[model samples]
Target: MEKTQILPRATEILPVMTAVMDAVDEESGKGQRDEATGPLFSENEPAAEYVTIGCSLKGGYRLTGVIAENTGESSIFIATNGQTERVAKVYHRYKKPKEEIIERIKSIRSPYVIPILEEGEIAGRFFEILPYYKNSDLLKATPLDAAFVAQVVVPQVNAALKAIHQAGIIHRDIKPNNLFFSDDRNSVIVGDFGISSILDDRQSVRLTTASRTLGYSAPETAQGFVSTESDYYSFGVSLLHLITGHDPFLGMTDQQILKVTLTDKLHIPSTVDNTIAQLIRGLTVKEREDRWGYDEVERWCEGQPVPVKENANRVKNIRPYVFNGEEIMELDKLALALAGKWDEAMKHFARGYISEHLLQIGQDLASTAADYEEETNREFGFFKLLYLLNPKAPLCWRGEFFTDLVRLGERVRECLPEINRDYADLLESGALLHFLRTKQLDPAVVDAFARLKERCRTDRNEAYYKMAFLLTGSNLMKWRGQLFDSVDALVGYLHANREGDIDAMAEELVGSKYFYAWLEHLGYGSILKQWRALPYGR
Candidate 1:
């Protein structure tokens, strides 16, 4: 091994070229030869204006002048064209053909992978060229700063693996050094497909004569089981590295790293969130059967919600006082009525007539209209305000209010779209009636449910599905038996656009313990069974 140095002009050339030239010069018995015979640049070429940095690694190569050096093991450099930058990885000569690995990597078409440029010998040393990236590895950064690692990197990496596996290629080496970040810092590119194995036409595997980095290699690889799943295990290990900020076998010696990987003693970081930690452990399991396939891993990543910080102590207390006067009065009236002080609440409601408080109350209420709870209110006080204002207000406002509340509940059944009722005001007033009667479901609730169903159909928004399920589940519980007809109608409305994880929805309903009876009444037993059978065991 030779000591690494940063040369002034070395940044101009490919990283692997620099490393190979430096290694040969350091290791060769003949030290600095005349400039004419030196490996870098043509003998007659003038020492270019670019600076060259060099370094030596524990392995066979000495790296001379980094093409691009930031915080990771790989080097990036500009291609001869000067437009696109390429990465250069110079590994020890291996028995497996390099061209085969190059071809396999080139076949993958994911944005997460760095495409190979060209591969050949330069100055008697073999090197591979990859597209140069401008982002730092999550390995060297804190997990807190790399929240995108879990949200973006892991998902994209898993998706890339699925594509690679589909192409029948196994990346025997999957680790932090192989993962690169794109210029924007929002995307990642997996590089260095060295040690990758391409399966033959028959699905049964053939062992490739190659060695992987000690800490990141899978156990079965040691036993010669070189399939796509082995790469999955490596991906799992890479994820662990990102989360824990240390290798799984970090403190262990080389022999120990190899030994513990063969045994079950290797432990994942328990301090990690349980969902992610479990994913890590499952991926690194010695038994191939226990390991998740790339698609399954992708699904798991999809299912995981962003991890919420647990300790509220660090959170800054910054509540904004956002209530308007009308909203405050409405809330006070509701609170008073709920507290059995209906007479005082009614008095406050009537105060608008004498004190000309309607305008102020209306403004205040309008201010609080955005509050989720206030938007749900549907009582007589709300209607009374609307009725008083309808004759003088803008037609759009009055019409919207009317249309939103009609047929809101059984109590306002008379206000529904009958022969002569104003349709807009009827809907609004009905919704308001429903809100007043239930106090749980807001007037906006039904619209939200309708929008959720549309989004599920058109956009497959999972959040919408979850929200709609929650709202319907709550309403079903409140209306149970008494509002069976209405609940059934609402269920039909919700069920029409149901998509994704029905079992999970059932589990959520069951977990709440509020909608179980309603769900049963809705003939959901078989639905629940099928839901439970889905991948998430919903």
Candidate 2:
């Protein structure tokens, strides 16, 4: 069944509404109030103000009409200056744009990249204004012939990618929706750098670990690794959709997509032209090292012959292992299958079927299998086996993917009060501890897990939270749903909101002393003292 459209369409404000705003206040009081009021006035503020309802930005762009609402990261709206219209992106409260990345993007001078006209904070939220392209995004302009994409779209977007790559920015989210047509409607320009990552920066901040758009996301991204090649992988997926006139993974659930795409070869339909197929295949190679990048793509655009490198490491399933009624050739696929069917997987192991097949595949895998066989808890053994099978796959327990140790800690925090069974098993069963030891992570991180493991046995809920706090380290702490990277950030949030409930929650948390002690341990004692002295704390 098709999804019902429950919301109204995003539309421009009618002539009637603007006339009313014009009558309300002629000058509209630009920047007269304190900075705390809202978005700062744009230097190019129009003389006649019409938008009295929506907020205005410091860049002098006033949001005139809704273009897209609640887009997870930001709300898209039409901003105006009376004489011209522009696109405004009002970021969600928790999903603020990284200023460093925004600054880099602003410095880029490329016709292939959509320009950022203005950017600043308004009402404690970040916003960006861009020239409204008359032509809509590439998602709406699909079913184009392979010829046009190869000749026009590829060259333009590749150029944009080249510019951003040189700027040390990895456009993590590159798909049809984020690619827009130029004003002339002849070329494509990349937009929406909100989720892009900046390389080589030790102090870089990421909003979330798994930020890639599924289906288009590179396989390595599923395991929490992304590079310039990752962006090219997404570009390839977008090209597939444009040329094929449909999503390659359409109608498949997210899990189904991940299972197949991550483990199997991308099946470019044989019906596709050989030239276009080669380009798509090159860009979407499963191995990032073998995947085509700027140099290969640029040469292809220049009409020079570009050879697509095959993924030499992709397993050939010389002696396939049958599982869950399917022939599994690769270790990664076997790991996914076993994780999916726990009971069946255990049965296979008990029968010595899995180990037998592993021995056939390789001695190393067979050795890992032998070690897991000795685990008292079969479920925990299964988890260990899965990890051994594919260490690069997200450390999955039960069914969910906790992309990394930090993400796993976040999950534990999210499930406290009634801890997640998978989390409990991983911790209490010593599977996580085993993972920590084998992975050889930072000793401090390992020590944090040891503490977490002991706490799991004691039934102290605070210990679980403490483990989360410790594991998070310099990363943002997921607390009661809100995220805070430091005591100052938490204090700043409390000061700004100041609701009765918020203050009460703050008082309760500070009274517990767990949060206070954690902050102190991190050497934020002076900051904690001031916070406690405030009315929000005990």
Candidate 3:
């Protein structure tokens, strides 16, 4: 929290330490992959059973190589039966797939869906093995022409969805990573139903909050409502990615993507084929009630006319407000434009250009706009108006976008070197207090913010950093990118890595009252004393 311990210096210490650690690991042969041994196949032995890396499983499978580590639901590894390679998804400690859903999925077999070859518990942690394709996934074969996507991809995935949905399951994870292709690329198989859930009578259920992939997930998924329509939305986004080889929401923060998904329309480029664009529009509709499903996709595939309920949620403005040379008729689109081009929108608002159209929507909005026009802090007032226009939109201040307090803290951390003045200003101005109140947060939460704002006014940088930590709900001590969960762990690490002015490093950390308060809150007073008692003077 000290200004002297800026990101440049703090970040500098870790790479050297990390290099030393890596060298030690290399010399010791630690964390290295073991080469596979044994023939790929034998005429006498069946292909379903074998071993490679000395470790064996309950089934005839053996892990050969790692494909991906620490995914949302599991770690993906390559397993072999000597002759054939298979994908093994080792589930995270508490993220096993529902047995009922898995059984249902297994019963409804389709060529478009990869079957679960084997499943069992290893040390009480669940894992499933499926056929592995050497060609990887649809992602690697993307930027495909419209003809291939429409003629080949659509029908195959549509069949997969029909079977999955008929079995009363919603495959919540439906992005490119889950869609695999045959060697010929003619057949696309949907796999990895790790976070899938059974649908209720209403065809919707609240499921897995932490695992939904951003940009691919439907807007309603943000509220934990998973439905068949949500899957279709993801499929549509996947189609977009296939056509462009670029995620439209790439480089955007999760909160920003959520805002775009909830409030604005998905803009299919005019350059895209008209038919493909129509399909994307129908599938990516913000309103779940109006979004395309199996029937519409089938109809589209059959060269039949599909009725799309476009602009179902658009506000009927008496007269359109023009901005960025486009007529903005919808409240959501207007909010999007205002946030997207904030400075220009602010200038327009100052001239009372938007107030008249706002009056048509609601007197309250018009009045709010009028007040904001004269407010001392135009940025705060304008962003508040933007929020009022679109309640689902993420909170925005000076071009930075974040959904809640946690993301704001993360943004603060990213810019710790030369912290933004707007952050301090916004904290002290009661704007966040008002914003939080609108969300109907607990009274205690509002009271905490009020108290924090008072503290922020004193030592601007130190107090702001404290507020950032509070917002993030993080106690992890970060050295460069390395994280330590507790004072004991951090202190122990420092002790082990004590070289080159360890006292100076200890002295710098102890100087921050912010660090003291954090350690005290975690009840690490004894550990703090021990840390200070190190040959270093405190």
Cα lDDT for residue 253, candidate 2: 68
**Candidate 3: minimum summed lDDT over ten consecutive residues — where?**
33-42
Better of 1 and 3 by lDDT: 3
How does each model score on TM-score?
Answer: 0.42, 0.76, 0.63
Query: Which prediction has the highest lDDT against the true structure?
Result: 3
Top TM-score prediction, candidate number: 2
- What stretches of model 1 exceed 4 Å from their correct place? 1-80, 90-97, 142-146, 304-538
Q: Write the per-residue lDDT of candidate 3 for residues 1-538, one digit (tens) a residue.
A: 3222221323232222233334546787552211322221122331122223444565788888888877866778898887888888888644577789879888987999889888886654678888888889888877888998999889889999989988888898888878998867778889888778787666454443334677888876654357889899999998988888888888876546766788767768888899999999899988888899999999999999897896654566878888899897778667767877778888887788777778887898798888877778666777677767776565566555554455567666566434567787778776776676665556786787888778777766665666666675556555535565444355445555565566566556656555554554454444345445444324
Candidate 1 TM-score versus the reference = 0.42
lDDT of each: 0.47, 0.70, 0.70
Which lDDT tens digits does candidate 2 get at residues 256-276? 777756777777898787888
- Residue pairs with clashing backbones, model 3: 40-82
Give per-residue CA lDDT, model 1, range 418-457, as digits (tens). 2223322333345323333232234455566444445444
